[model samples]
Target chain A: MHVLILGAAGMVGQKLTTALIADGGLGDQALTRLSLVDVVEPPAPAAFSGAVDRVAADLSLPGTAEQVVASRPDVIFHLAAIVSGEAEADFDKGYRINLDGTRFLFDAIRLVGDGYRPRIVFTSSIAVFGAPFPDLIPDEYFTTPLTSYGTQKAIGELLLSDYTRRGFFDGVAIRLPTICVRPGKPNKAASGFFSNIIREPLSGHEAVLPVAEDVRHWFASPRAAVSFLKHAATLDSDRIGPRRAISLPGLSCTVSDEIASLRRIGGEAVVARIRREPDPTIGRIVAGWPTNFNARRAAELGFVAETRFEEIIEAHIEDELGGRFVS
Target chain B: MHVLILGAAGMVGQKLTTALIADGGLGDQALTRLSLVDVVEPPAPAAFSGAVDRVAADLSLPGTAEQVVASRPDVIFHLAAIVSGEAEADFDKGYRINLDGTRFLFDAIRLVGDGYRPRIVFTSSIAVFGAPFPDLIPDEYFTTPLTSYGTQKAIGELLLSDYTRRGFFDGVAIRLPTICVRPGKPNKAASGFFSNIIREPLSGHEAVLPVAEDVRHWFASPRAAVSFLKHAATLDSDRIGPRRAISLPGLSCTVSDEIASLRRIGGEAVVARIRREPDPTIGRIVAGWPTNFNARRAAELGFVAETRFEEIIEAHIEDELGGRFVS
Candidate 1:
């Protein structure tokens, strides 16, 4: 099977690329070609016996999306987006890249009109749900995003559903929870602390706890996120019906719970590495985010995530630390 | 108050214009200047001393939206959109007019900068909701529009909320129920029959009921619709928070209830004028529509509608039929 991966340079994209290369295919088809794209040139996956093409281009630019879709890959993984903090700070750039860029790609595919309907797997975010949320957000709750990034993702979900309903393409939008134990340095995303608190401690470094321990949030492992994308590409569209977007299953926990899990996996020393540093700006931004969700629809559709915070930490250690932490 | 109506040539637009002219202004302000725009040149409201400019322009085209916003009307009634059947049949035109046009206008207003935020009352539709619905769809129900028209309106609502939240404009999207006892002749909208059975019969003409009598739907009068726009323009945005879209309250009843109300208003002779010639295509389309809504939010916000089907029919007689039916 031919495959295309947008945003292939990002952490999740790189991991997804490695996973696809290792599997030698997606679903039941053997990989014959792989096209990877990002604003920056993505690295070539090592040891993959396929026709690989890596290109550095912005999808929002004129004709760039057309260039990406020209290959007519069987499945397209759209993982490109500006992080929340950057999008919030730069309004024009945010709308241009997140909203207009996505639309450009969708339109390009639509214009390919020779009945070429590829399976599109879009990465949406739980940020689509803003504050004043119920204790447990249900699958059918209204989306009233507070941030521009969330708004763009929400719009993308709408477009995906509409385009799929119109027979332009078979698409699935997975609203991923905050990916915890993210194996990377802290980023500018408002939700970055959810990962930094764990990743930094495991690496024998101090990490600031921006919010109170009582502050709760939803999470999924990077492994689970990649799995969600893989499953989405091959999932039965008939079962999904016209509602193409689904809130993926996730584990709900608080900062205290994360600390407890970190201590359990990496001893008290690692947990002690976390420093209490109150950052009101991040707190206020995170406060408006949803902490839990009743993702019954996604669970019933066979999407899975880490059940416990400990498991999430363990997965990170195994994947990023070669089965061990600094301790 | 300087007011602008984007689709001043359409039925709702014209009615809203007339109402605004008669009221002397919106809210407590007196009429100063009026700007009316549409793809066709709008008729000037009569007996108004205010400066009026009616222009034929397509908002989706370059610079058209900028020109419209140049006047910087205090309140903008964005009522332009191709009807459902037409939008669904002509895909490009629908997105261009409904989605792109609305976005262009919003962007134009945003570029006006200098804190020039106007009260933008956008006319959304119940089409934003899809079928296989609960008995009463709640205020927080997810938007999973099944038609292209519905999709466009849903996207517009997203843009409206985002733009409003960013302080670019003070916007409110009112999801209007199907206007019953409509004054004009039937158009191509699948929901056209809802008005036809009542409108044609009251005008001493035969009308076709395209679906079973048990087919239920939500509705309001053209008068109520106009009131919705006016109230939306003056409603306190502070109370609305970040979620700018609202489902307006309306009377929910079945086709049988409508006919029963017709009998009450125009006697059995008028009810007899209704012909049962079922068109399955329209029936299928209508079947996928929401039957009812729990518009408690709108009700709490003081948006009122007919409580009884008889009152809805009476409203038609009083407003459109000169207080008497053809009989």
Candidate 2:
């Protein structure tokens, strides 16, 4: 089946594309054609047998969504968004890219009016939840996002639910946890430390821990993220029921637990590589995030997340470090 | 103190302005300057001694908010919007007027950040809640809006809360129940029948009941609506707490209750004027609406609603019928 991946140039997008290319399929359906789109043209498909088309365009631009949607892909993966830090800093840019972009794409699919409903897999985030949350946030908690990025994602979830209810498209919004041990160089996302402290330290590089050691967070691996995308693409829509959005399952642990996991896996030397230097900005932002979530709906839907941080670290090492540790 | 009404030409806006004029004051603050704005020029203020400036302008137009905010009124009552039925029918119009217009006004206020924080009373609606609600929806129920109108209102509530939390403005969003016995010629609102069946029959005219007699709904009189706005405006910001939005108290009753109250007030003859004609479209919409809501927050904040449908009808007669119903 033909697949369209929006924001195909980004980190998660690149990983998801690589996974699809490596597998050559999602479930029983083979990848006959892959359409990749981003603000910058995506890298040429690496050794793909399937027909690959790359388009560079901004979804927030008025007509860009229509142009991309005209090709009628069977499955559409909407992964485009400005990161949390940047979105929170720039108000107009945040709403334009995160909110307007998602809406424009949904509206384009709606206006097609040909009764060709595609499966729309939307990438939401844990940012949709805010402070004063229950210890274990249930799937039914109210969305009161603290930042503009969270607000935009929450709005997108609402729009997706409504549009799907209207039969414009079959939509599913997966609220991804902070993907731990994120490969490659760190960026400006507030949650970057969740990955940085683990990935950098394991690679024999010193990594700064900006928050208190006791600070807790939810985590999933990059492998789990790809699994979610693939599962979301093929899962029976009826199983999702009426609520199109769900918080995905993940391992919940404190910062100390992460350090302990590192010690257990790579000894005390690896744990010693994490330097404690608190940044108040990051600390304040992290304070509002939910620490743990009970994703009953996602669990029931057969979605899986790494139960252990060691395995998460191992996955990152195997994928990014060629299964070798620094000498 | 200067007061600005954004939709002064609309039904509720005109009535609210009239009430403010008749009261001769808002809380203890005497009305010094009144600015009335609408797409059509609002009626001249007849009772207030203050200079009344009536301007015809569309809030959706660019730079209109800048002009309005430049006046730097002490209080802004934002009552502007395309109605629910119209908003649901036209998506572009809905987003333009409801979502973008609200944002523009907010941004304009934020830009005027010279320690000038005005009290902004935004009119939200009961549409923020949708189906599968508890028998009596509590303060913290999830906002799963079933219509475009509800979705937009829900988003507005989120923005109002966030902006207020950020100290951009002293804002409060009051989600008013559907006004019972709206005193005018019936229009296109699907909920119009709720008012029409009561008002038209009381006025010695036949009215059609579109849904079943068992369908229930929440309501408040136009007087209550004005009271809500006034209370929202004057409320101490501290009492509003972190979440600046509130669901105003509304009387919840069934159609039979309304008919029973109508029969008691105007006798059996008025009840006889009602004709049953079930329209599935309206039934579907009404079914998704919450019939009973426990507005604990609003009550705690000192806003009240009429308890009995008879009181609601009596309110209509006293206000619209000039203290006498048609014989």
Error in Å for residue A6 of model 1: 0.9
How many clashing pairs per prediction, in order?
A: 0, 0
Please give the interface root mean square deviation for model 2, in Å: 1.5
Least accurate 10 contiguous residues by lDDT in model 2 chain A: A318-327
lDDT of 2 by residue, A189-294 (tens): 9999989888887789999999998999999998899999999999998888767888999999999988888888888787788899999999998998999998
Off by over 4 Å in 1: none
The per-model lDDT (C-alpha) reads 0.92, 0.89
Which predicted model would earn the best DockQ?
1
TM-score of every prediction relative to native: 0.98, 0.95
What lDDT does candidate 2 reach at residue B296? Answer: 92
Give a tens-digit lDDT track for model 2, residues B1-327.
899999998889999999898887789999888899998999886767788999999888999999988989999999998877788788888878988898889888988889879999999988878787779887766777888878888888788777777778899999889999898887666799999989998888999998999999999999999999998999999988876778899999999999999989999888999999899989988898889988998998899999999999999999899888755
DockQ of all models, two decimals each: 0.87, 0.56
Task: Give one digit per residue, the lDDT tens place, for model 1 in A1-327.
Answer: 889999999999999999999888888999899999999999878898789999999998989999999889999999999999999999999999999999999999999999999999999999998889899999999898988999999999999998998899999999999998888787789999889989998888999898999999999999999899999988999999889999999999999999988887889998888999999988988998999999999999999999999899888888999987887
In CAPRI terms, model 2 is classed as medium
